[model samples]
Target: MAGTGGSNPSSAAAAPKILLAKPALVTAAKYNRGPGGGGGPDDSNRSRLPSVAFLNLLSDSWDFHTDRFLPFLTDNTDFTVVGVIGPPGVGKSTIMNEIYGFDATSSGMLPPFAIESAETKSLAKHCTVGIEPRITSERIILLDTQPVFSPSVLADMIRSDGSSTISVFGNESLPAELAHELMSIQLGVLLTSICHIVLVVSEGVHDNNMWRLMATVDLLKHNLPDPSSLSLSHPQSSDKEIKDKIQEAGEEYMASPVFVHTKLHERDSAPGYHVQVKKALNQYFSSTSFNKPSVDGGSDPTPLDLYFIPCKSNSEYQYESYYSSFWKLRDQVLSMSGPSFSRTVSERDWLKNSGKIWELVKGSSTISDYCRTLQNSGLFKR
Candidate 1:
């Protein structure tokens, strides 16, 4: 017999009474959890919601994290990966947000990539720490990375003695300055290998550091295979085999780059200035694969994929308005049928292979040797 105001232990263990509230709508917010009860319409609705606005693919320590982002990617093989790299305050994330098709005017809609706010600029802080990834409803993967050659990033990685705080180059200690440079190259190489389209953004028409960095990347990114070519079983493949794989793909594989020069003053938007800038860019990348002729037999001998974005403050000028340039950029980039991987690969596999490629980038002997050379030259303190 049960005691007064108390249930029998055996009866309570056999059938416990539980109360559950009505299942809430999880699709209305990002990263919402479904009802605890399994197998219901609520679960399906929760699955259909969009992924989180952004996930850090690579952390400030240069470590990779994929678990949070892998679920968002489907087995879609037709998607394209677009990556952007540039210096701070140059609007890299802003451009990526535009490419992400984010509705800025919508109330309560957070951007896929956060733009640099006035407060952030005043504090001299960078918005993105490492590589941030986002996938759109259209299955396009966008990667917004931390600003290269950033003083704040450098400061964070520098020790009191000026050695790197992060040990990316094996056991050897690297000067913060030299390590920062290598970071830029590694980023460029990884993007070129994995992405179908890479936007090389620069702040002003006169700033050519990003151009120089890409040239360095093209020079050092030898024998680094794209994600589709990477294999799990043959992780220890010989260099010759890797070289052969790259050769089989083509003479050399590089993501088609779209050079975006932003924040141009009104005078820089003049027709003459624009033509001069285009000519200069054509001459800069003339010898690289970026200048290679299209396989489709297009007319231009050295096709230049360049876009100039004027300053928003200069919208009062008679030339192309800021919004107009952005619209044109969006249309052109969306319509472009850029280069493809050697073989078809689903988005999940791509992410996995990309992780392996990043490991290769970090352990690259070429880069390691380059760091030693820089150290020997006394260019940076050890």
Candidate 2:
């Protein structure tokens, strides 16, 4: 099954014969079926219930038997599958440890699954993953690429050892210059995920990242989905993988109600981990069951009310250059962008900024006059 809120306990009490079909992982992902042909529980007598969202801990070779598999998404200790992205050293492990309670201070609990390279490290295998509440009848599982900040590293790992990484990289659009491509693509995916996304970077925010967000906004707004389902065999990918690509863009972010907590570590007493997420849910997530803050900041949601996670937890200076680089470009564009830009400006800065600006702003005075001068630039329109 793709995912589940909870299995019906009553199904077992009813003396139902549990279907014990050990379908291969690939088949499960492809068809979301048990050994039989359908999604129904193995024993038809059992009341049909959703399957728990399976966490796929992929590596150069997937390490399925890791300690502390589920991440703590909210105050009540919500359980959700988190995909860590980044090169090996960019703190994917460290971040996962922090979020999923992988305490080096203590042993952890490990769920049994297919794990490669089992000899690599010691698993704590102590703590239990929290029970998660069912939100939507439709599966609302979270799937992400690892190492939030190291887009370059994840790309490199995928390109070099991709044959062993996952079939998605093998049979998919391989990027040119993978250094940060995988991370970027994956971030783009979380930007559109089903649950709240916490894109953690050791460094602060940048313009390029915002542009990435805007690109998603534009595409989704224009009725385009990345790797648009129309272009690929939609029925083949696992539900988790499909959820990975849904970048959760809303019509609101275009108008600026989206609140971001960049350089979270830099914040002075940033409300601890739980408070911050609760605040984010009130800010970003819109649901009827949950309490939402008003636009005017009327009230706040409790810690248990939010569900968010850390995608990047940069420890060193790895993502610093990336953040700086994007900001430089972002500042240049925002320097002249309109209230509503038809084109999200990144991949075309030189032509769009210098060449286009020279044609538009050369006759202008200073930065103060940049925006107005660009009105007639005819660049964004072009």
Candidate 3:
């Protein structure tokens, strides 16, 4: 549901929005604040997480995550597992490996996946996953339904006597005539454990690609019920009155999603493009559900929930920046190969976009001063 706080943009005619909030939160580096990704004993990663400071911080792995809630998932929640599903070669494995540490790699170091195990089996030796039905505090399961988008994989899974449940991944990619069956089966890869949606746009967006993404969003919106009409399903829902208001305004708290033309690889104006895409989505929501103004005079619209799940090729993920950050982090931690090339993401943009942290640095006279002040001004006190 959308927020009713002034923090949210006024949107009766428009859909209120919220930030995903992960990008802003900062924490001390786990490996002695070193460039390495060592498994450290530092509490900073979890307990000392800094408050919201950046826009894309929501994409950070540990940020906004709740390990305490892990115990609540046992036989007590509607969401039991995160079913990672996506088209073949779409970096489903890569994304999951990065976020969840599944030991998936382009390197054939890990054995080819096993398809005939009746029970959950280990995809790697590091973790004994999917071996039994038993659920421990480590009960958060990451199920991998076969790639249903491909006809051959579907046939293989169906023919197998092992796991029989079929998860339709990206069934929207299927024919329009197969919508019903597809919708029922195709699983959105990030089902559980709150996987952030990283919409990797294809390398290039021709006119047709834009139409495809737009059409996909339109289809999903049409099939799902509006939050306004439904009772709050989140068991740990926040303040009671806020819950009521959110449900009341959920219908109106929408996004404006414009078909952005920029390449996902470009960094200079990505924020501008993100805002435009959001606008297009919000407008469509407004047209369908006209949420009434809050009589209580409160506002807290959050648009960050509107995920732009891109249906495109694997071009964006192959870009240098994503590869550098992910792979370099991987090498630093796992002692893998490091590529010989430039790797410099402007800390300025990320710093500036972080509202909480940026405010402190905004008045600085130089980068060194800003860095020092930022480092000293209690960036994580909140």
Candidate 4:
């Protein structure tokens, strides 16, 4: 049976109300089952939800006790998983906590899956090692994943000679670099598969972290369902054909990533910053062989919305107090609703299905095979 942590009735009612009140302000994410049937710190004392580790999903030693977790997700159809993907120490957790209403001062009842502020610091090591889920509202579940591409993952790739060495589940095609960057790849897989809206966090506009987004976007475009007739031949026979297909397919099948530029205070917040960032992104997208954004800001939904926020509460510099800026961001996320995505996955099923994908990722032997698994995972199908 799924465990609700023996939660109370009043708490349950409040979470759903928050989720349903603003139908557009919603999100969801992935988690792997563990032997203990839960992940992260014991939130019993703090009255918060436990965030799970993704590495646990890859461990053969840990038993995936789905019964304890699936009940939370299975009990509702309206749950929307939201996740943040970016480099290490970029305020992904800070952004997540704010979105989920993890305020220390609020007197109102906490949301159903309220997350604890993710452990953070200035150190370079990865803080979030796995996917952590918290029910923010009755229908809104927020997932905070480990940084997709961190220095640690990069080091692992270098040490492995650009070879994918980690496998706990199935033969998969994936680049050595991507395989080593498991957290990002897994987050990419989850966002592409299950999430409703993804807040793509970054340190700043010029930060190299955008490369992570670029790679994930490329993966998404590559995995788009091939038409029956096109399967007989390489539909992408030409650059023009490739671009045309992507546009025609539309972005509805992909997770609508709203880029949130963090650490805004450190950079010159001149009037030209937004314009400069947009221009740079436009140029970057156009240069890509495929999956380019519309240069004219055309009707095509290729490029996503981008916004800026100052510092997060956890920042070492605390460049500026972010309480007001944080709420502003919350309001924006609540208002901007995009195209619906993926199949109607009950919360319980999401947990089970995500675990299956992890297994496949673990079993793969080559980068190409892992990529194939991700594309064929069928999480992106509408």
Candidate 5:
């Protein structure tokens, strides 16, 4: 759970200047120019249109905001929840904006997720606070999370006495540093349990901290049930039966992970280098369910969903331009027929159950035990 890079180079070059749209300002402008204000017919109609802004699905305090996002979802059973996680300034929000199909060229329109501006980058700040959710016209739900292993986030949660400001571990008091580490794992477990496709992003090819973090997540994620497995009525089920059901669900379910390494240099995009990275990824996750073959009984195992996105300034790799790579990534993600729930569930129920799953993640005894081990090792100050 050690911290990785001191600064994220991906944030400096991942997003194009043209895609810089201020979501907060655009949202505020819409409310101010409502029917109450003196406006023409077109202005009123525009105000009534659905605001293309992201909602805080998970707040900074580790609380889930359910009611605010429920209005955006319908009872439609057909939908996809895609979540992204990485260190701060790794362009998590920028990639999500592209997937949301935001038209940055249009005037007065805001991107679904805001990209980190140059001013924000200069100040060494992050754009997304927690998990920001945006549902597209295609009913694709995108969740952009605050960076993991973030020094800024750690600073916010730590107190003068070294204890954590937030009670993420329930009644147990923990060092802010330890709690911050656990927070990242809990975020990964929650996304894997609730989302159909989780984007595991990294700044560059050399950094493998996120990969290690996910391996730890897979280890600690035990007896945690997915959102689809929740049920309101189980009157006849015995205690043993319930435990067995949860065990089966945990062993069978895991979100399809797509490893995205961004901000690559020209040399990193060479055909030989790309093949080596893909092979390494397959070897790293070979034992995990991420490499499981299709349920259709295909003989060959599914290859690891690995992608490399080069920096925008790299014109030498014209075949895989930054913009074109993003477009391809978006298309492949949307078209992927990922693993589905054991049973059909409505969108509202999915949101409601996801909240329950979050609680389980917070109270997980497996993760709590791991924290004790880290504390005993004296790796982080108490």
Candidate 6:
């Protein structure tokens, strides 16, 4: 259902509205911390906690079960996975921290994120390297991923001519940075496959690169292979053929994309700032088809559930700074009783899906294929 949170400044009789949170929660925690485990410097005992584990790098391959929660997933609990993506330093983590019920100022109690007091502050660096899974309850799972467009990650994105703005590699061989970013995008696609909702947060306004990033996401989703139909027995099916099937099957009911415009100055001089953002986003998505192609066929226009949260700046009470608005957003999330998609995968299925997609990423001939696909599809066109 479309939300009533947005309104025109010129509309005089606007009713007070409560914005519904996308039917799930999105949050992130430190990779080293375990559920109910202390956030001490020592992670030597991490093996004991299966629920919170780190993802493997190229040097090390991750067995999905090793991240733990495999056994818990088998218990048949209906869990909602919420994935949060945003540009670096946009307060994605901090906003998620608050939504997960973490109050930075509270001393005696542990924050839901379980990070130490010192680690709570925002930093320019990519705090999350890979997918950091945090389980708030048996029914809730939050996947906090690396910030999109972080210099560390974008430095990996090579040009069409096989040259990056920054030289991570001296030769034409696929740079490790490109491979790594590809892996991250694959993870985001995997999350979309299983997540109940995907929350995309951005600071200020949307830019060309931001739109292109989202466009690539649309392509990936349209091309993502169906988990059930894919098997080791059928190794002959090409990626394009698989993608065709995915497109034919039609778009899976996904967590509706909720665009959050954060860090607003809340100035009296800018009373219409929120409305202006809503207007721009409405026009952008309407004109762009929300980054999906019309060749895929059209569905009814999906409501843009955009919400604005005031800038907290460097305040210690960042969560409290917009506590009232936060509460309303929080209530909407908690109250989401939306029915699950018929295509929703169970936890074990999610692991298998992850493994399958990871193999696809590794098997692809070149990372440049993604860039070309996005470009040819006109996803990044202004």
| Model 1 lDDT-worst window of ten | 14-23
Q: Rate the local accuracy (lDDT) of all candidates.
A: 0.74, 0.28, 0.27, 0.49, 0.73, 0.49
Instruction: Write one digit per residue (lDDT tens) for candidate 4, span 258-313.
Output: 67777776454454777778656655554442343456888553554677766553
Clashing pairs in 6: none
Residue 251 displacement (Å), model 2: 8.2
Name the TM-score of candidate 6: 0.64
Residue 193, candidate 2: C-alpha displacement in angstroms: 3.2
Name the candidate that leads on lDDT: 1
Backbone clashes in model 2: 20
> C-alpha displacement of 198 in model 5, angstroms?
0.4
Poorly placed runs, candidate 4 (over 4 Å) = 1-68, 106-124, 153-165, 168-178, 220-252, 286-303, 312-321, 356-382
The sequence of per-residue lDDT tens digits that candidate 1 reaches over residues 146-233 is 8998998898899988889877776667888988888888999999988988999998899999999999888888878877785433
TM-score computed on alpha carbons, candidate 1? 0.86
| lDDT, candidate 2, 1-382, per-residue tens | 2111233333222221211211132322332323133443344422233233433223333222222122211111111222322222323333333332222343332211212133432331211121111111111222334333333334344545332233223243322333233324433332332123222233222213433432433333322222112212343544344344443432221222222323333332233644655454444434422233454665644321221222234444422332443344223322321122122221112111212212111122222133234434543221
Residues 134-223, candidate 5, lDDT per residue (tens digit)?
A: 665455678888899998888888999999988787777788999889989999999988888999999889999999989988888776
Better of 1 and 4 by TM-score: 1
How much lDDT does candidate 4 score?
Answer: 0.49
When 1 and 6 are scored with lDDT, the better candidate is: 1
TM-score of each: 0.86, 0.32, 0.31, 0.60, 0.84, 0.64
Residue 209 lDDT (model 6):
51
Q: If ranked by lDDT, best first, what sequence of candidates would result?
A: 1, 5, 4, 6, 2, 3
RMSD of 4: 11.4
Q: In model 5, what lDDT does residue 47 have?
A: 45
